[model samples]
Target: MASERILSKVAEEQKKHALNVAMATTAAAEAAVAAAQAAAEVVRLTGAAESCQRFRKFDPNLAAIRIQSAYRGHLVSPS
Candidate 1:
């Protein structure tokens, strides 16, 4: 009867350990997915910024002229 009780206690401990491991695995997976999503967003924003730089370089004088014209019309910088 003592051996049976010891076995039962070990089984309970094993179940608790298994549950803890499963929760940790799930949390790690969620973190990995979030990191991937953030990386993708960074890539997308980087591409957009690069595209704008290209446009600015394509016609520097034209962009400056447009900015001046807009400013004259009372369009202030949002910054």
Candidate 2:
């Protein structure tokens, strides 16, 4: 019957539309995951850089203290 054929065509079109929607959804999810990973890497690297900066600041003070203590000891010791 012509009506049955029309119904079948409509069903096929609906299926194709559904498939397109599903594909688009999958692509969007993949893009979001990639963006999140990139953001996390940026945060990690920033934290590591901050930690290195803190250590650099601490190192100079520690070195100065060690040098001063050694100089003091040399001055106090008898030749």
C-alpha lDDT values of all predictions: 0.67, 0.68
lDDT string for model 2 (1-79, tens) is 9999999999999999999999999999976865665556556655655566766565645434544555555456664
Candidate 1 lDDT tens digits, 22-74:
99999999768656655565566556555688665676565445444544443
**Candidate 2, number of clashes:** 0
Regions more than 4 Å wrong, model 2: 54-79
Worst 10 residues of 2 by lDDT: 62-71
Runs in model 1 lying further than 4 Å from the true structure: 54-79
Model 1, position 32: C-alpha lDDT score: 82
Superposed Cα deviation of residue 62, candidate 1 (Å): 23
Error of 1 at 25 (Å): 0.1
Measured with C-alpha atoms, the lDDT of residue 2 in candidate 1 is: 100
**Candidate 2 structure, TM-score to reference:** 0.62
Clash totals for all candidate models: 0, 0
